[model samples]
Structure formats: C-alpha cells, structure tokens
Target chain A: MKLLPWDYGVRNLLRAPGRTALGAGGVALVTALLVTAAAFVRGMNGSLAETGGLRNVILLGAGSEDSVERSEVKAGVAGIVAASVPGIEERLGVPYVSPEINVALVVNVDGQERQASFRGVTDAAYLVHPQVRIVEGRAPRAGELLVGRFAAARLDVPDERLAVGRSVDIDGRPWTIAGRFEAPGTVLDAEIWCDAQELRVATRRETLSGIVLTLADDAQTDDLDLFTKQRLDLELVALPERGYYARLHDFLAPVRAMVWTTALLVAGAALLGGIDTMHASFAARIRELATLRALGFANGAIALSLVQEALLTAALGALVGAACVLPLDGLAVRVSMGAFGLRVDGTALALGLGAACGVGLLGSLPAAWRCLRMELVAALRAD
Target chain B: MSALVECRGLTRVYHKGDQEIRPLDELDLDVDEGTFTALMGPSGSGKTTLLNLVAGIDRATSGTLRVEGVELGALSNTELARWRAHTIGYVFQLYHLVPVLTAYENVELPLLLRDDTRRERHRKVAAALELVGLADRHDHFPRQLSGGQEQRVALARAIVTDPRIIVADEPTGDLDAAAADAILDLLGALRRELGKTLLMVTHDPRAAAHADRVIHLEKGRIVAAAAATS
Candidate 1:
C-alpha cells in the first residue's frame, strides 16, 4: 500500500544490471535529439516573430509580402504620407514614422562566407521601435557602423569585439564597429547598424527599403490597413506587432510540428527498445515475481511495481536529456530571414524542456503498458 | 466453523483445438486450521490442477470452491485477486525468488498489499527472515544464495503476510534428499509452531511423509485418504 507505481517500476528495471542501463541510455539519446530539434524550430520561429510589425511596414515590389529588402519607397513618399496621415501616433512632438534600408552582405570574415544583414536607419527609426539599447561605447556616428553582440561573436571579433574603434572590412571598405548593443534574442541582434544615407549609397538600389510607423492614440491598427487599401497612388500592407509575429510563426509552423512529430516517431522506437530491455529484465525475474505473488502480493501490486520501475527510468532519462540541451540556450548562431541573421532565444529553451518531458512520458508508455498487462503467474516465472 | 480451504465437485477441463480433456473431475477437498496435508499423484492426475483451483489461481470448469468462507467460483477476477493476496501464500517448485531483490525485499513484497508502515513492513520482513533462519542473509540477492537458502527465502516470503493458508506446489522438487528433508522439517515446524494451514502437492514420499495426512488423487478424483505415519 505504501509502494508507489514509479518506485516499483524503477526497482524492477534495475533487476538487470546491463539491460536497465541500456534502456535508459536509449531513452536519453532519443530525448536529446528531440530537444535539439525543438530548440532549432523555436529559435528560428522566435527570431522571425521578433521582427516586422505595424511599427514597420515594407512597401515591397507590389506583390512581395515576403520581404522589405526587395521593396522600394521614395524618401518623398515618407514625408508626404506622414503629413497626409490623419491618425499617426506621435511621440516627443515628432511623428513616429521612419524610413529604412537593408542589404545582406557576404563578408569574408577570416576566410569564410559569413552572411550578415547590414541595416541602415534614420535617427527617428529608434523612436518608432524603442527596444534597442547600446550596451558598450556609443551609437554609430554618421561616419561609422555598430555591430550587435551576437554578430561580434560570430565574426570572432575578440575581446575587443564590437568595441568602439575596432574595424571589420566589408567589400574592401573599413566599417568601424563604433559601438556594441544588446537586444537579446531578436533578429536585430545579428545585424550591423549604420547611417541610413551612407548605407543607402553603399548598397544603392534604395529609394527606401521600408517605412515603420507607430499608431496614433485615437487610431487603431485596422485604420492603417483601411487607409492603405483606399489609397489610389499606392498599395500598402499594415499589421499589428502581435499579428506580424503570428504570421511569421505560421510560416514556420511546419518546423515546430515536425519537431514534435519526429520526437514522437523516434520515441516510439526508443519505447520499443525500452520494452525490449524491460521484457528481458522481467523475463529473468518471473520466478521472483511469482514468488512475491506467492508471498501474498496482489496481482495488481505486482503489475504496478513493474510499470512504476519503467516510468522512473524514463523520467530519469528525460532529466538527463534536458540537462544535455540546456547549454545550447542563447548560443550565438544565425539563420537566414530575407538575407538577415536571426538569433535563438528563451523560447528555444522552453521548447527544449517541453520536448524532454514529452520524450520521457511518451517513450515510457509502451514499456509500462507491457509491464502492467502481464499475467502474474507468467511474469513471476519469466526468468 | 470456517475451513481455511475448501473445494467440492471441482471439475477442470482443458481443450486442445476441438479436443476436450479433463484435468480435475468432481473432486472435493478441505483443510482445516493448522492442518498440513499433502496431495500426491502422477503427472496429468490433476494434483496440480486441484491445487490451482483451491488456490483460486484457475477456474474449475464445473464445481464449487470456497476458501475462508468466500466462494471462489462466485468471485470475479478482481475479487479473486484480493482473496489470493489476503488468504493464500504460494510456494512453487522453482523457488521463484526475484533475483534483483534482496532476501528482505523479497520478503517485504507481500506487505506491499497490506496497510502497513515501512517500520511495520521491515519488522515483518525481519521476523520472517529470522523464522526461516536467514536473518543474517537478509540483504543477499537470490543469486548470492544457495538452493536451500533460496527456498527458505521463498518460504519466508510466503508467511510474511500471515495468510490463512500456505499453498505449496512441489516445494522441494529441485532439492536433494537432505535439502528436501530440511524443507519438510520446516513445513512441519510451520504447522506446529504457527498454526498455519498447509496444502502441498508433491511426488516425493519423504516430503509427503511430513504432512499430518496424505490424500491420493488419480485422474482428478480423490482415490484414497491415509493418515501420516512418518
């Protein structure tokens, strides 16, 4: 009556020295793989969700909702739209609309084709989106550029990484890493920032890559879309910050689903492997179980004990696997998003932990079921 | 007065494809409190089948069985299980001691079904082990023990719950004469010292000689009943 299902199962699993260890290791390996896959999916989707909201609108090449990089809007368009807009949100007595430009440059950093997105922004762009903060040195001067903390890591920029006055050449021109900033886990954390006009000229295809605007106190997000749709001279798209990320998440939804599905499928195999180990262990101890039954244990008690042992082993394996994936949290790595670099974040860690629990429970089921389903008389003599 | 074990007209049948066979036919048996009885027969003579039915481990094809006043034939699987745990303790020919468990753990397994504290369970396991003369070997794994020690551990496990009846099937089948005698002597002591009713199935005459009475079964019916003279 005092014995728990988990405790009994664990004891039974330990009955075989070699087989129990093998089952646990199998569960751990599969769990780790599951966590890692979930991490990647969460990392990518999270990075995408962090960028492009109503604060920013890409006036793409008419049909391209996919990127602002290929889009163009004249500097004159920003001024006209700002003045004509009746309900744009204002901050510090200035309209919170800023024009921006972007380019993905393949920099030869220590002999590798490292892909980095270099963004050019007007001073007011900081007001439109307020999350950015300079952590080291100062903001880029008109003549210099700034690199994010993660970008600094990827380029092996040293202890002087992203330090003021440190320089990295892009296309034979030295762009000084004038300052360092941290916007942890956002896609912006992997991009280089510089003066809009300079980048506009250097990468020159720009009328303006996109415009970002804040909502007026009285104006809701829906008004922006309605206004854009009603305009005859221009075609536009507008979405709220939450809505923008949701779209990005939807685009990458398959990756997330696959993370779970792959884990489940692989865990199915791992569960079978665990069952094999458990079966072998129980097979050898059948007589012992029968003897226990003979000693007055109810059949329910005996079956429960075996199931408990299997679950405990699997839960331990999951804990081990979660520990294995913990170190990958926020590691400096990049993936492509309209040629921009994206960062892994806290969301990835959560997904990894979730995957660990899933592997533990799902993988433990078959073995536990087999244990519980056994006939007491047969199981007792299994050895 | 309630008999610790009882069976009446117990008929157990076996079918092979379409061929029906009878293992136990119209058998009746009863063992009162503190009595030790040995049931003997050749293979296929339903000695083991009778033991199984009386122990509530198998269904009698047709008959009435009552162990401790609870009709075995009237209980469902779940109830039968409860009955088995509280009323009967079993010893198999193979000893069947779980290899992973220490002697104490093996003995404590039965108490898992009882409402007992860890202290109570430990006390019971210790006492059972002591009773079997293996208190010092309480932590030894089954593999670490000799055949006789293992059987004794099995015996300790059977009695730990203090069940009304101890049902043993070929309890000494694998032992030599000396080991077999030691086991029978233990059974004799169990009956005299603890007043635990004992029902054993065996082929060994020496083992049977330790019982207070002997019943001969042939083709599933009791053929003769003889008082123990040894």
Candidate 2:
C-alpha cells in the first residue's frame, strides 16, 4: 500500500514545539546515559585486558596467587629463576626478569593523603612490559619516583602537581617526582614506580612481591612450571601474566553487572516516559488519523507514518547525545583498582544510537495501535 | 437506470456492556446513478450510519450493500479500503483537513494512493482546487482559511480523486448560513456539472432542497421519499 508523504511526518513534529522538545530531550538523556555506561564497562575491561603480557609469567609465593600485592618471593628469586628457567628471554646477555614489589601506600600529595598503588621495579620491567614508554624525564633513581600518566587522576590531584621536580611524602619521607611514563589501556598507567632497592630500604621489606619474566618465542610455559615444581622449597608458583589479569577481570564481574543493571533500569524508566509522551501526542491526533482512514488510507500506512515521525525525533536526540559524548573520549575515570579513561569509542556510539532508535520504534507502538484501532465513524465524531 | 448504491435489509448493531443498540435495522434503499440524494433524520435515526456504510467506511452487521455492482459486505477490510479509494470520496462535517497539510497537499492526498505521477497528481489537484474556486489559495493551510473556504478545500479533496460517487455526512453542519448556502450550491454544481452521483446526510431542509431527491428516515427505516421542491 502507498505510504504518506515523508514531509507529513516531519511537519507533524513541528505542530507542538514544546512537546516535541520534551520527547527529544528525554531520548537524548537516555542515549547519553547508555553511552556513558558502555564507556565505563569498556574502559575498565580494556584496562585490565591490556595490562598482561602474553609471553610473560609471574613467580610469586604459592599461597598468594590471587593478588601480587600480597604475594612474597625471596628478594633473590629473580636471579634464581633467570638462571634455572631454560626459556627465559635474553637481550644482549641480560635476562628479561624483573624483581618487583607491589604495594598500596598512603601518600601525602599537596597536603592531602591518598592511597595509591606503588610498584618498586628494576629496569627489567621495561623489557618485559613493552607497552610502557617514558614520555618525559628519566626513570626514578636512588630516592626519586616515576609517576604514570593517569597517576594524578588516581590520586585526585591536578596533572601539574605531579610534574617532575614535585615531591610527595611516602613513609613520612619526601620522594622527588623524577619522570612520567605511559601504558595506554593498561592498569599500570595509574601506579607510581621507584627503584626496587631504595623502595625495599625505605619500606623495610625483607622480600620481593613477585618476579615477572618474559619467555623467548620458542619457549613454552611448561618449562617455567617445571622449574617451579622442581624448586618447591622456594614456595613459588608460576602463573601466566595474562591468566592473572583474566582472573582479576572475572573477580570484578559483579561490578560490571551492577553497572549494567543500574543503566538498564534508568534507561527503561526513560523509555516509559518517552512512550507516555508519544501516547499523549498521538491521542490528540485521533480524529485526524481516523479522517485519513476514512479517506481510504490503510491502518498500516498510518502506523508507518507515526513510526517515521518517532524515528525522526529519535534521530535528532541521538545526534545531540552523541555530540555531547564526543568530548568525553579518553576522559579519566578513577575506580578502586586504578584509573581508566572513559572510552567513547565507535562501539559505544553504536550501542547508544541503536538504543535511541529502539526507544523511538517501541515507544510509538502502543500509541499508534490505540489511535488506529478506533472505529472510523466514531473517530470522525471524536473531538 | 440501475442503482449506483443498493442496500437491502441493511443492519448495524453495537454493544455497550451487555446492552445491544441497533442503529440501522434491516433498512432497504436505492440511490440511482448520476443523481443527488439527501437522507434526513433525527439524531439516532441511522442516517449518518447508512451514509458511512455506503461510503465503505463502516460495515453492516448483516445483509447486502452493493456499490457499482461490487458487494461491499463480501470484501475484506483491506479490499474495502482499496475499493473505497477507487469508488468513493468521503466528506466529513468537520472538514477534517489534516492540520499540517496545505490545501493543495490535502486535496492531493487520495490521489497518492494511486500510481499517478507527480505531474499527473499536480494536474488533478490544481483542477480540483480551481473548480472549488480556491486555486489562488493553494498554499494556505486549513487554519489560514475561513470556515466556508475550509469546507471548499475538503470538497476539493473529495473530488480530486475523480471517484464514481461522493458521500458527504452533514457537509454544512458546522458552517454559518451564508457559508452553508455556498457549500450547498457547490454540492449542487458537483452533481449537475460533473454527472457524479451524490449521497448526502443532512438535518437541514434547506441543505436537502439542493438534492434531486430527499429520503426521510426515523427509527432506522425510510419514512418517506419525495422529489426536492427546488
């Protein structure tokens, strides 16, 4: 059957500017909320997923495999593993083994105390985790500290406050900010790093938290496992770096679920409001709809016209919502684990727009059915 | 001549919470081709209901309604709508012009149902508006027009499709005396000049006087039939 002219639906939206604005604005807010929730989930998952090196393994105390911060290996374990493991990668005769200490410390920044992730590392960390790149200044020396790009966000401080030459008090002693590093899309971007020997001396730690070792291309993880098993007296466990991060992601599944549930509930309420607005709009046009039917237009044609009107309104809303969200791309968001940037990427945008259109299509159905189901003669008689 | 519209034992029933109301009960009538007929009756007399059934906008609960040799009762709703597009032009008392559409666009609505080209549609719409003496006001919306002018636009919409018959329900019911007279004169001109069959329902004798024949109804049955004095 023939449909109504496209301009018919377009012009109807202009009949009541206030109502149209209300409907469009509701859809816009829902779209923006959905985009933000998507960005949060994506950013969090991405940060965790990108942190682990595929060819690396972690050697930590067997009982503390869940959290490296709680894991303790002997301070000499890095050298022992590099010598015992046959497949440890070597560059210019130096083994790719990093003895690291992962700790959470309360630090005073600009007179404000904040809990921050602190990693004590040797130079081998750059060899194993290639994603890390120092963008400015140099690696931390003797009593200095290296800050990650997102460290300021995690510490709730301004970027200028963490620049090189600034000092933060750790263990009641001030450590100079010597450099800045970036590990994009990784949780490490929100941690502070310092020389392991100095950190051990300052914190009075007797053991290293863990040892991270990269394997050569021909090497298998089975080799590391075999070495760990043979050296059981060391009380060490060999775990793939990727598997550790994956477990961490699974541990945070409930947070993601709560995020989605909350977003869905709010979006659902907005959708209902949109439906009510459309119902009111269409109900006021019952007589006109019936007149079209009486003039030989089919119910399907009229319904299509109504849907077209809804889609146009929703598209306008989606455009506005997307514009509002574009500037938020890569915006830093702080969580308990660390800080990750809100990723308003293409997938997030697609989901937001898809939901807006879905609202438009679904919101119009009840109203269209109610208006079109009326008896033509009675509808013509309606005011 | 054979009747263009024939209704035999036509009945329509409505139910409201266990109460059955019969608006038209087994009414029989015939409206000849190329003639203007007016149905006159009181408020629940089924005059408008019969007009609606003839226009194919409403259905009879039982019995037969034939327009141009097609049994309207036997057709499906979709089929009836298609048939209505080709066979009938309905004019409502309120004019019922789509508020968003200009007079030209309103008149062009029914023709869009057919496969007419844009030029062809424009040609017919322009002629219809010109015939109704609103050619100069083609771009004016319904709100921009006076009551008589709006009804004329509705009339223009009714005839734009060039259907075989036009059914008008109280076409002058909402108009002032002078406007009502002008609409009646135009209705008369449609039948006289175009040879188009007209079926109209009106409570006003002055409106009925424009018809070639007037049928009086009470309690769903035709009480009297007479030639118009005019």
Candidate 3:
C-alpha cells in the first residue's frame, strides 16, 4: 500500500504548535530533573573519594570507625606509631604524621551563630593531606585560624567576613584569621584549622580525635593491618583512608536513593501526562486517519507516522533540558560532611535523550493503534 | 463491455446492543468496465456500504464480491490494501485532505507506496494537479484553499496513482451549486477521457444526471435501474 512520506509527521507537529510546545516542555523538565539527580550523586561520590587517598591511613579508637568526630585515641600514640611502624611516609627526614583534635564549635560572625568543624593540627598535617593548598596568606599558629574558602559559605557568612586579618569569636575566644586555603574537591574545604595544643587547652580535651598519616611507597593496607594487630593493647584501629570514605558513602546511601526516587516519580508523571495529551490529539484526527486508510495506507504506516511526530516533539524537549543542565556543571552543593561539585557530563545528556525518545514512542503508539483499529466506516463517520 | 465489479448476494451485518443491523443484505449488482454509474438512495439504504465494499476498505460478511477479477472477500487485509492502492481511487464527501500537508504533498501520497524515484513522483504529482486545474495552488495547505479548491485537490490526489476505478461518495455533498457542478463535470471527464470506471453514491438527483446510468436503492435492495437521460 501507499506509505505516508516522512515529512508528513513534521508537518503534523507544526500544525499544532501550542500542543507541541506543551508536551515538549513537560519532557524537558523531566530530563533536567534526571540529569540533576545523576550529577548530584556523581559529585558527592567524587568529593568523598578526593577527600581520602589510597596511600593514607586513619588511626581511630577501636569500634569508632563510623564517625571521626566521635573517635578518640591517646595524643602520644602519634609518636609511638611513627617510631614503631616500618613503612611510614617521610618527607625531608620528617615522618608525615599529624596528631589532630576535632571539635564541633559554634562561631559568631556579624551577630549570627553557626556551627563549624574546628580541626587543630600541626605543620605536619599539610604533608599528609596533600589536597590542601594555601591559596592566600600563611598557615595558622597559636591564637590564629586558617579558614577554608568554602567554610565561609558553609557558615552562611560573606566571603569577606572570613578574610585574612578578620577576627571570629569561637567559644568565647577571639581568634584572628591568618589565611585562606582550598582543598580542591575534598570535604576538608568546610573546616576551620588552628593550633592543636591551643585547641586542646581551650576545649579542655586531652585526647586526640584521630591521627592521619601517609604510607610509604609500596606499602599496602596489610602493613597497617599488621601494625594494628601487633599493638592490640593500645586499643587503636588502622583503616585505609579509602575504606573510611567508602563507609561514609554507605552511610549516605538513603540520601542518594531518596533523590533518585523523587526524580523517577517526576519523570513518570511527565510521561503519563504526555500520553494523555497525545491520545486526545490523535483522537481528534480519527477521521483523517481513516481517510488515509481508505487511500490504501495500512494501519502500521499510520501508527509509525504518529510515533515519529511524537519523537520529534520529545527531541525538542530534550534540547531544552540539556541547555538547562549546562550551567550546573561544577556547581557546588554543601552537606554536613563538606561541599561537593556536580559533574554534568555527556553521559547525563545521553540518558536524557534515551528517556525522551522512549516517552515519545510509548506515549503515541497505543493511541494511534486504538484509532486505527476501529471499523473503517465508523472512523470515517467521526466528526 | 466486460464487467469489472460483480457483487453476488453480498451481505454485511453488524450488531448493536442485541439488535442486528444490515446495511447491504444479500444484494447483487454489476458494473461494466469504463462505465460511469451512480447509486442513488436515501440515508441508511446501503449505498455507502456498497461503495466501501467495492473500494476494499470494508469486507462482506457473506457472499462473493469481486473487483477487477480479484475476489476481495478471499484476500487478507494487507493484500487488499495493496490491491486498493493500485486499483481504486476513493473520493470522500468532506474533501478529506490532510490539513498539515500542501496540495502537492497530499496528491503525491499514493505514489510513495511504490518504488518511484523523486523525479518520477514529482512529474506524476505535477501532472495530476495540472489536470485538476490546480498546478499553481499545489503549495497551499488544505486550510488555505477554498471548499471548491479543496475538492479539486482531493480529486487530483485520487487520480495521482492512475487507479483503474474511481469511487466517490457524495463528492459534491458539501459544495455550493457552482462547485458541485464543476466537480461533477470533472468526474465525467475522468471516465470519458481517461477510461477510468466511475462508481459514486449520491442523494442529489442533479448529481445522478451526470452518470451514464443510475441505480436506485431502498431497504438495502435495488428497486430500479434506468439510463440517466430517461
């Protein structure tokens, strides 16, 4: 039988420009939501990985692997491990080991109070955590604090409020901002760093929260596992830094699931709405389809033409959605742990196109079939 | 003249809520090749039903129906469609041109089913539009054309495939007298000049006058047959 030309579908889409726009808009919104959700998951995972490195190891009190803030070990254990462990990373004859104290302290900036992680460390902390770079000003000493660039944002204060030379009140003590540092793509970007000894005296805490150290080249997790087993009486646990973040990622699984579920629900609703609109549109043209059938075009051909029309509309919607996602690449999102940047990559665009085409075909095919299945005379009688 | 369409006791029955409706009940009829015949009847008298069966768009519930020596009742839906595309050109009462397509594109539709090249399709579509005196209006959409112009475009679409038989159901039903007369004259010319068989259903007596012969139907049965001049 005679087949309808490909241009027929395009012409039909333009005939009802308003409906086409509405359908396409719905599809575009769904695509944007899906892409955003995917980007968020990617950013969160990447930031967690960047915060932890393969050769680094964290030493915490036994049975406190879930949270570094709650974990504690004797402050003197840092020196003991450095002298005992054989494969400890050393720079310029100095072992790269940092004894740290983590305290959740409230800071007052411009009459506003915000909670922030206060990390107290020594000069050796910079050697173990290489992601940290002092972008402006020097490192902090006693009575001085080094603020992360993102730390200001996390505190809901202006960037200039945390500038070098400004003073911030932390737990009734005024500390001068010595400098600003950036830990590119790491959770450390959301913390305040200060002198460990001063922090211990101010917080009335004698115990260190954790010790961070770098393993020597060719040293594996087995080396730390042997160290921890050899000194079980110390009540210390050694965990590969990668394993630490992987556990944190597991803790945040529900958040990722919730985001994905919400995205899917929105996308599903958009598909159903598109199908309803397409059904009504094709129903109104029943007589015209029957006329095509009478002119020797088969039912399959008519259905295919309708599907092509719907896909074209969806493709337009996908283009709009991809445009919306363009600005979100490298956009930062803050959570309790740290700030992470979203990666809106080509994979997200590819997934959006697939979903848009699926919505287009699934939404239009059934409606076309229903119209074509009616008796020819009855279809022709439709007004 | 040899018979091109033969309907022997053709019956079509449908049921609606415990009641059976028969539009064409055991009806028998014949039309010669290249003849211009009109079926005149009141509403629900089976005129349109007979035309649909002859055009291969509908099937007979029982009895044998043959068009151009092909037993239509025996062919599957796909084969019947292929046969209709090459054999019959159907004209509708409402000038059912697709609103989205230009007159030239609409007329070129039937040729797309075949393996014709772009140049061949263009040549055929251009000639059909010219024959219907609409070559200049080929680029206009159905909505852009007047009722008379739309009907002429539909006529051009029908003849574009060079079908052997042309079946028109009240081709002039929606037109004014001027347009109706023009459409009737065009149908007559297609039969006389191109040797295409013509089978049309109409309620208007003036429209029947254009046919070489007329058959009157009542209650799904043929009641009278006469030369239109009589």
Candidate 4:
C-alpha cells in the first residue's frame, strides 16, 4: 500500500481472476497472430536473402535478370565461365561453378496435379550452395532424384511418398528418389534436384537455366564484366546473386504487404477489444482509486499503479504467446517459389513482446486517465 | 490552547445547470489543539462539507481556512495534497479499507507518502494496529474482518501517519451499540493519551458524548455550541 508497491498492482490483477485471464488471453492471441505473420514473412523473404550470398554470382541469358527459372544459357557455359572468369572460387582443385537447369512442371500427386520446381545439379552445386545438405541417404546420381525436405509439402504429396526408393514420374519418365536433402532457409527446400544430363534428356531441352558461381574472397566483378564483354556472341548477363534476390524480394512486396495488413488488422481488433475490457475493469474500481487519492496518493501515482497492472497482464500474455510460438522454429512453410522454415529467433521474440507491451500501454492509459479525471468526491461516491 | 484549525468566512458552492447550491456559507469556526470536538446536524447541514474542507480533500469556493497556521485556500492543489499527507488523519464511515490490502497494508498507506524506510513503516504500522487492538489480525484483509474490526483498521490507517489532527466522518454510524461504545472510548483515549486534536462529524448523539465540545449546524450556519455532559 505504501507507494503503491508493485505487488499491489499485481494483486489487483489477481483480484478478478476471470477478467485477468480474459484480458491476458486476448493479448496473447493477438501477439500470436502477429508473431505468426512476421515469422511467415521472415521465413519467405529470409529464404531468398539467405540463398543470395554476397560473393555468389549468376550468369543467365540476356534480358532474363528477373527469373532464374526462365533464364537459359548453353549447356557448356559452366566450363566457359570456369575458364574465362579468373577469380572463380576453387575448392579442392574443383571450380565452385554449377550449371543448373530449373524446370517448373506439374507433378501428379494422388491423382491431382501440383506445380513443383526441379533443379538439375551436380556435385559442384553443393560447393556453390553450401546451405544444401543431404540429410538422409545420398546425393542423386544418374537416373536418380533427390527431394528436398519440404518438397512433399510444396508438391502437395504425402511425406512418405517422396522417401528414398520411391519413384516420381517427370515428363512420362519415372525417376527414382535416392535421397532427402535440406536447405534450411532457402527456396530450394521446396524443389527436387537431379542429374543435369538426365533432366536434359528427360525434358529434351539441352539448354541450361543458369550457371551459379562463388567468387573468391579477394575477387572482383571486373573480370566477370570482361568475360561477358568477350562472350558477346554467347549472349550472357552476369549479376550478383544478392542483387537478383533483392529484386525478387521487391517483387514480393505486395504479398508481404498483404500478410502484414491482415496481421495488423487482427491485432488492431484485439487491441480495441482489450481496451474496452480494461475500461470496464477500471471503471468498476473508481471508488477504490478515489479512496487511494483521498489517502494522499497523487493522481499520477494511481495512474502509474493502473498501468503497472496492465503491463503485468501483458507480460503474462507475452509469456503465453512465446510458449506457443517458440516451437515454430524450424517449422516448414511452403510458398509459391519454394519453402522456408519458420524461425522464432531473438529478434522475433523481442518484437512480439514489444508489441504486447505497446498494446498494454495503449489500452490502459486512456481508461485510467478518464477514470482519474472525475471529481474525487463524485468518484468516491460512485458505486 | 492555540487553535489547530481556523475557518473565517469559509464557503463551498456547487452549480447544477445555473442553480447555485451553497453547502457551507461563510462558516466561521475554530478547533483548539488537543481537544475532542464533534459537529452534529441534520442532512445537508454542511457538516460533511466542513469536514472535507478541514481534511484538505476539497477546496473552499471562498474565504480563509487554515490548519496548523497554513492557509488552505492559498496553497496549490499539489501543496495541499502534501499538506494533507503530513497534517491530517481521516476516517470514513464505510471504513474504506482497500479490499485487496491486508490490515497492515491499509495502515501503512499514509506512511508510503513519507520517506520512511521499510523498517520504519513496519514499526509504525505494527504500533498503529496494536493501538487499535487488531495487532494479531494484521494479515487479514478488510473483507475478512467484521464491521467493527474493519472500522478499527480504518482508524489505524488514519492515525498511522501520526498526524496532528484526526478527522472522522460518522466513524461509528455503521456499528452496533457495544462496538460504538468501544470506538468512542478509543477516540476519547486518543485525545487524552497523545494530546491530538479530534474533529468528527456525526448524526448520532451517543457518538458525540465522548467529545469535549459539540457544535450544531443548520443550513450551513452554526446554530449552537455546548459542552458534552460525558
């Protein structure tokens, strides 16, 4: 009671256990929605950003900077870039360059067709994209296919259907699934990877989609510029991988906006509901607050006590939201392009807690101010 | 003895849609230090209004009201609040002990405004609760106590600040005869033992018997003053 100790506010919250639970529940639900939406954007955009390493570069056909899937170069362009580009990173004497063929095709799953991306890669693809790791079985060889961990979800197929020893038909040709791979935070996790030659023969398209390369730490883009200039007949465009993904991220702005707008509206609705509830709760305590005021407590002190109570409730709500959201870390979420894992990292957790606190402060102060502004005698006389 | 409270032409007015209602009109009064005095009157006779003004919980619309030589009308709202914390102890008819707080916490409410350390607050709250004969029930909340016990707790809170003047508004109005006698006896003991000034407003004549002096009011004017036979 002295100085309205913090526990006084806390005990007041417990005085009406039902109301506290309802208020805290409302806050928790809103916070969960907020964290879920943010984790979704974080998972989607994070995949692209993580995949686009700063030192990596992509060589595509002329006039195809936007779509790596649609970009096409000659099948032999990988060797040409390895030889022409002087700073191509070397790993164990092998150049870190991968000539990949990306095919977006419809795959039949349980008699229904679902669109999926298939990438044609070789052993050097692993060196160029280190995020990709074979978590089960081994890498795909000729006549074999490797499915990403989240490929089943992206393809709308049963998880066990894409396991090792299963077969998937691509363009009327049955390909054996030899392994399962995981690319933790990349769009590639929603695709299948197979031998480039086998995919070329199966699709009967000999052209490669693009060539990805890792530049040496001390390397510069000037050499790649010169290479593109010298290979004018090849009709190639060299671009930094990060810049390419950055442009793609910009293209996905509308989708991110949609997600954010929906999330905020939900949170706003919850906030208004919470404010109304808190207003009623504090209104019922008008005489109590007036009594404190009569006992020499300043209006500011009583208001502080009210805010402290609200904040304590919100903190409890945040704790509940965190308990529900932290498990979402590493949970796979499928997107149109590929799949990425949801992550509730420290930043995401902090953001959720901050949003809950903001709701608490915004929800309680106005109600308290209105209640305290009443004349002390009138308030004390109120039932 | 010198007067602890002085009111010269003290008045309070309220307006209800252009209708002016004067609760206390040019009221002139004085309460000496260490004396027990009671103000009695019918409903709307300005007894509670005068008590509120003296307690510094309400402002006077016009005129001078002083407590311990500080003119209440001259002080700002904030300064008046500080003055009330340091100078006045008020007990309410409903025993307005915060339902959520224990007896000890209610008693310590006034002490929180002061710069007393935790140890000092504990000592004062213990002594005050002991003085009210509820020392063993310090941990009990208001709802846990009977009507008389709750009033005693409220009294403890009022006096815990060790203020110079104690003001009660119908302190024994809600109690039974035995409990009323106990409360009146305690109020009488406070004046005799601590040399404290007591000013109380009451409608019950038996409740006023413990006071040394009783003032009657009618329509915001002092109609008569008399000595208590008890």
* Candidate 4 vs. true structure, TM-score: 0.98
Q: How is the predicted docking of candidate 1 categorized under the CAPRI scheme? A: acceptable
Which residue runs of candidate 3 sit more than 4 Å off their true CA positions?
A: A1-3
Q: Give the root-mean-square deviation of each candidate in angstroms.
A: 3.8, 1.6, 2.4, 1.5
Question: How close to the true structure is residue B93 of candidate 4, measured as C-alpha lDDT?
Answer: 89
User: Residues B1-230, candidate 4, lDDT per residue (tens digit)?
Assistant: 55789999998999999999898999999999999999999998999999999999889999999899999888877787788889999988888889988999889988999999999999999999999999999999888999999999999998999999999999999999998888888899999999889999999999898999999998888999999877
Name the 10 consecutive residues with the lowest summed lDDT in model 1 chain B: B92-101
Note the residue pairs that clash in candidate 2.
none
TM-scores for all candidates: the values are 0.86, 0.97, 0.94, 0.98
* Count of clashes in candidate 3: 0
Instruction: Enumerate the candidates' DockQ scores in order.
Output: 0.43, 0.83, 0.73, 0.64
Flag regions of model 1 displaced more than 4 Å.
A1-7, A52-64, A81-94, A106-115, A150-172, A216-248, A254-261, A293-299, A338-383, B1-4, B16-21, B116-126, B176-178
Fnat per model, in the order shown = 0.41, 0.75, 0.77, 0.50
At residue A357, candidate 2 shows an lDDT of: 96
Model 2, range A1-383, lDDT digits (tens) per residue? 89999989999999998998888888899889899999999999999888989898988899998999999999888888888889889999999999999998999987789999999999999999899999999999998999999999999999999999999998789999999999988999999999999988988989999999999998999988888898898999988888888889999899999988988998899889988999899999999999888888999999999999998999899889888988998888988988988889999999999999999999998889988998888888788
Top candidate by DockQ: 2
Local accuracy of candidate 1 as per-residue lDDT tens digits, A1-383: 33433434556655565776676677667767766776666666666666654455434335545566666666666776677676777766688878778778766655555667788888777777676788877777766887776775555445364567866666767777778776654677777888888887777564877677876666755666666677746656654655555676787677668767887788767666666666666555555555555444555566566655665666667667667777866666544452223222355444544544454455445544555456554455564
Each candidate's B-chain TM-score, in sequence, is 0.97, 0.98, 0.98, 0.98
Instruction: Specify the highest-lDDT model's number.
Output: 2
